[model samples]
Target: MRIDRTALTDLAQGAAFLGSGGGGDPYYSLLLGQAELARVESFELVPLDSLGDDALVVPCGWIGAPTVSVEKLPSGLEALAGLKRLERELGRPIDAVLPIEIGGGNGLAPLVSAARLGVPVVDADGMGRAFPESQMAIFNIRGLSACPSVLTAACGALTVIETDDNLTHERIARGLSVALGGIAHMVEYPLTGREAKDHAIGGSVSAAIAIGAAVRRAREGGDDPFAALYAALRDTSLYPYAGELFDGKIVDLERETQGGFSVGRVVIEGFGGSGRMELVFQNENLIARRDGDVVAMVPDLITVMDRETADSITTERLKYGQRVKIVGAAAPAMLREARALALVGPGAFGFTDAYRPIEALNGWDQG
Candidate 1:
């Protein structure tokens, strides 16, 4: 499928929702994608099954605090430079590129690289949604090695990491992001077509596009965008359940750029002095509490959006006095499995509460 400007816009909208208040904001990414679309007609997306078994697929994305990414723009050569270096390192041409995560800016990030490399983007990603750390990717959760990964910054600096330990790879990459001014493009977990087909989260690209389209149409038709968003999410097999978690205004926010990540929390008070919702984050939203009760947790999708417009407000974008609606969606089923939970569940982030389905906790299942 070819991704044009319309699809790209919808993609940004949809990706922000899927990002679960992480993956950085999609606004800048949309601008970057639009700029590229003006030069090229469209971006080509190829299915995983279309590639040869031996085809080399590189997962590409921007790595850094979303807060920093908004201020420090890319030099437009980061992705291409990284991919070119990886090609040199492997002594082989890459057949395609894919998003490391199909949420926020990362979802559209690989397009420029693919265009420069003259390669197509695989219709899949390592993480179905954005996670703060590289080790949280499904590629790592599935036991894939992240070593031999390449990191590139806007300043023309490049580093190739070769580690048997994925966690250490994340540590090294995080440090590099901090060193490089809090943002860099990465091409990691180079995969064979076979491995991509078997382990990578598939169809997330198209799903994002579809979800965006649904919301756009609802807005144009003067329908309820939040309802449209929930309906659209429920229609997809990837996100099984979706609903509103809270409707309120931001009362307070505590955020800081720490260790290369935007870490903090936001407090939202209900409109009629009803209650409050608090969300904690580290690049991406980790958990949400309503009136001091755990209503949603990680590995499940949680996003805060404009109450009237349905535009997702990422962690870095939350501001006091903004009327917002917190939306929650189920993560891809694969990420909810026992083994997957060990890596992404609330416990993984130091929360004592065990993983629980968003639907179950919010009465969405009964609804």
Candidate 2:
């Protein structure tokens, strides 16, 4: 299978939806992917069945805060640097560049790396949506290790983490990210095409393009983009429920800016007996609760959007009186398994109960 120009938008949009409210903006990644596509010509659909068991596949992504990616901008050398470093350490040529997670800026960064490195991009990815930590990838459930992982912060801070366990890698990377000023650039978890096919979210890159296309068509037709998005996602059967529609004004936003990550939360007051909602975010909205009850949690997509426009608002860009809609959607079934749940469910982020599928929590009435 080959990804054409029209398919790129579908991938980007689906990724944004899957990003579950914190994968960074898809527009930037789309532009980046488009540029790379123009240079590379076309992306080959490397199916999982095509590779041998030991085909070398490396996951690539931008590590810092999404806000930093917008302001500071990557010179584009950092990912290549990390890729080269990892290849040297492993003493093998990386056969393909795999997307770490779909959504946000990280999704497109790998395309550039693939084009520059002249390697194919595996059709699958570690996470279907953007995840905050490095070790949250489904690969962990498959018993694959994160270390021997290589991290390269854009500012010339390079480190090779050799952890005995996946949890340790997440801990160490989080600290390093904090020390790096809240965000860093990294490439890790070298795997093979066969392993990638078995472990990663299958066809996620292609799915991103398909979702982006559906949204683009809606826009072109001058129709409702959100409704069109909902229709497109039906192809995936991911979100089975929608969360409460909260009308709130941002009363307070406390952010800790460091190492490129702006970790913070936005407090909002319910309108006309609607109650209150607090959104906790670390680069992405992780948990949301109303009246002290968890309404949405990780492994599911919780997005804060302009109530009217439906456009996403970044954690750092949120401000006072910005009317927003808090949306909760069910996570992908591939990620909803017991193993995946343990890593990304409500408890993984310190919430109490296991994350209930959005469909189970709420009716599927997104029309």
Candidate 3:
């Protein structure tokens, strides 16, 4: 599928829904993507089965603290800069662009890159859900290297990791991010179209646009936007679990920006029960365990929005007295396999037992 400006707009909206509460702001990312679209004449979506096994594919993305990105705007050439450095390091022409992770911000980063560099972006990504660590991609599970990573910063800091170890590459990149002012621009994960199809979260870009459009339509039709989102993701066996809309003041929120990531939690008290609910976040909302039992966790979409406006809120922007509605959606099944479970499952994030599907947790009263 060829993506045009309209598609990109829809994609940004859908990405916001999938972001699940912590994938940074989609607004800025969309503006950047739109700027790129004006320069590039077109974009092509290459199928996974359409390329040679050894064809060179490079994934480009921005990594750093979202809180800082708001104050520190990019040079507007970061992804292009990072991709060029990687091409120089590899001594090979980049065959295509790929998104390393699926999130509101990262999800659309490559579109900007593809438009700027005059390259097509593969219709797949490394993780269906956003994760903080560099090595959390399925590429690692498939025995791929994270280096020679071509790391770039907004101010023209560039370096290459020649190490074959993903963990070592992660450590190097993390340090570089801190040194470069709490954020690093990166272009890595060089793979082929065939490998991309075999491992990536397929059709995600298309899915994003479809879901976004559905939500828009639902609102126009006087239907629930959440229900529209649920239907769009029906293929994934994921649905939104509707709970009480916490239209109360945010009593307490503790946050710390560390290691180029935002980590924290928010506590909201119900209007009547003195019933308190806590949401834990690390770049993204990982778990929304009410009182005691775990209500939702990673690999599932846990999102917060305004009770009246339905505007999505980022974890970094969450305040101490925000009336928000908590909505949970299922992630794609690609991230639900035993292998993915090991990578992003509850235990992977240090939770005790494997997480049950969100629908199961909802049981009979899924509303």
**lDDT digits (tens) for residues 278-338 of candidate 2:** 9888777888778777766777777776766556666656788888877666667788888
lDDT of 1 at 167: 97
Candidate closest to the true structure, highest lDDT: 1
lDDT, candidate 1, 151-195, per-residue tens: 999899999999999999999999999999999999999999988
Better of 1 and 3 by TM-score: 1
Clashing pairs in 1: none
Q: C-alpha displacement of 360 in model 3, angstroms? A: 2.1
Clashing pairs in 3: 250-320, 250-321
Instruction: Say what the RMSD of model 3 is.
Output: 2.6
lDDT of 1 at 104: 90
Model 2 TM-score on a 0 to 1 scale: 0.87
Better of 1 and 2 by TM-score: 1
lDDT of 3 by residue, 240-356 (tens): 343332345568898888877888888877776656667888788888766666777778777777665556677877887788777777777767778877877778767786788
Model 1: CA > 4 A from native? none
Total clashing residue pairs per candidate? 0, 25, 2
